[model samples]
Target: MERLQKVIAHAGVASRRKAEQLIVEGKVKVNGKVVKELGIKVGENDRVEVEGIPLEREEPVYLLLYKPSGVISAVKDDKDRKVVTDFIPYIKQRIYPVGRLDYDTSGILLLTNDGEFANALMHPRYEVEKTYVAKVKGVPSRESIKILERGVVLEDGKTAPAKVKVISFDKRKQTTILEITIHEGRNRQVRRMLEAIEHPVLKLKREQYAFLTLSGLSTGDSRELSPHEVKQLRALVLHGKNRA
Candidate 1:
C-alpha cells in the first residue's frame, strides 16, 4: 500500500508535491470517491484520477534524445520556444529531463519517468562524468590544457580537475575543437572556463553521459533505451551510490 499522493506521483500524473496539491484542491478521486485528506492510503485495486482522467499505471520510461540547438531542455519554455517534450508527444506518461542542456547547446540528453533513477544520475555526490566537445575561438596551448586539467577558477569557485584533449584545429577559422569532460554540473561551466582562458566557445555539444553516447541518434531524434541499456544505467547509478 502507498499514500494516495505517492501512488499518484508514481503514476506519472504529476510530481509528489503537485499531487498533494491536487488532493487538497479536491481534484483527486479514488474508486469513484473524492479524496481530500492527505493521510489516505491506497492499494493496487484502487482507481485514482485527477480531474476526470484515470491515473496511468506506473511504467518507468527511459529515453535518449539527440537534442538540437535552439530548443529548451525543460518540459516547457515560458518564452514560447520549442521544448524537449515536443519530440515525444506520443508518450502519455509524464517524463522529465534528468539534467540540463542550455538552449544553444545540443547533444545526448536523458529523460525518465522514474524520479529515483533521475536523482541518482544528477546527484553531485554520484560524480557521474559528462563529456563535451567545445569549439573555441583559438587553438589552446599545452599549458592552457594543463591549466584546465589542473582546475579553472570560475565565479562560483575553483572547478574540479577536468580531462582536456585537443581534438583538432582549423587554420581558416582559427578555431580549435576540444574534448573536455567534467563531473560538475555548474551552469555554463564549460563556456565560462574557456572564456577565462581568453578563448570563448563557438559551439558546444555534449557527446557522452556516463557510458551512454549519441551514436545512433541524429539531431531532433529520440529513442527508448534498450533493455540492456536500461540495466547498464541502473547498474551504473547503483555503483555510484555505493561508492558515495
Candidate 2:
C-alpha cells in the first residue's frame, strides 16, 4: 500500500504536489468516493480515478545491469551522455538506478521502479554490503591495509570498518588488486578510501551488492530479477545484517 498522492504520481497522472491539489479539489476518487485527505492510502485492489479517468498503475520492474564505465547511472544526463536506461530501451516502465556508480567505474548495478524497495536498500541503517575489486597504483603496506580494515578518515567522516583483502599484486607494474567490502555508499568511496591509504585507485569495478552479483551478465547487459530474488532482497534488508 502507498499514499494516494504518491500512487497517483507513480501512475503518471501528475506530480505528487499536483496530485494533492487534485485530491483537495475533489478531482480524485478511490473506490468511487471523492478523497480530499492527503494521508489516505490505497492498496493494489483499490480503484483510483483522477478527473473521472481511471488511473493505470505501472507494475514495478527490477533489473540488474552490468554497467560499463562511462555510462551515466541516471535517467538522463544534462550533457546528453549515454545513461544506464539507454541500454534497456525495451523496458517501458520508468525505472531508475537504485544507487549511482561513478562514470569511470564499472560493474553490478540494480535498477527498479519500486521506490520503497530502493529506499529500503539505500537506507544507512540497512548496512547493505557492497563489494568492489579495485586495481590501485601501488601495493599498499600492511599498515595501510590495517587502516582500511579499521576505518579510514575521509573528508566526510571516518568510514565504517571495511572487509579488505589483497587479491593479487603485480611486482613489475607496482599495482595491487584488492577486494574491499563496505556498507556505505558515499560518492567515489572506494577510490577515496584507496587515496586515503596513499594507494590511489587505477581502476575499479563493483563485484557484488548484498548477495547479488554479476555472475552471468556481461558489460551493458541486464536481466529482470526473479520473484524469489526480489523477495530475498526485501527480507535481507528488513531483517537487518551485520555491517561489512
lDDT of 2 by residue, 1-244 (tens): 8999888866645657778899999999999999999999999999999999998889978999999999999999999999999999999988898889999999999998776677667776888899999999988999999999999999999999999999999989999999999988999898999998889999999989989999988899999999999999988887774533
Off by over 4 Å in 2: 1-39, 43-56, 241-244
Per residue, candidate 1 scores C-alpha lDDT tens digits across 1-244 of 8899777766656667778998999999999999999999998888988999987776788999999999898898888899999998977778888888988999989988876567667777778899999999988888889989999988899998999989899988899999999988888889999998989999999999988899878898999998898888778878888997
TM-score of each: 0.80, 0.83
Task: Pull out the clashing pairs in model 2.
Answer: none
Model 2 has an lDDT value of: 0.90
Q: After superposition, how far is residue 7 of candidate 1 from its true place, in Å?
A: 5.5
Residue 232, model 1: lDDT of 86
Tell me the whole-model lDDT of each prediction, alpha carbons only. 0.87, 0.90
Clashes of 1: 0
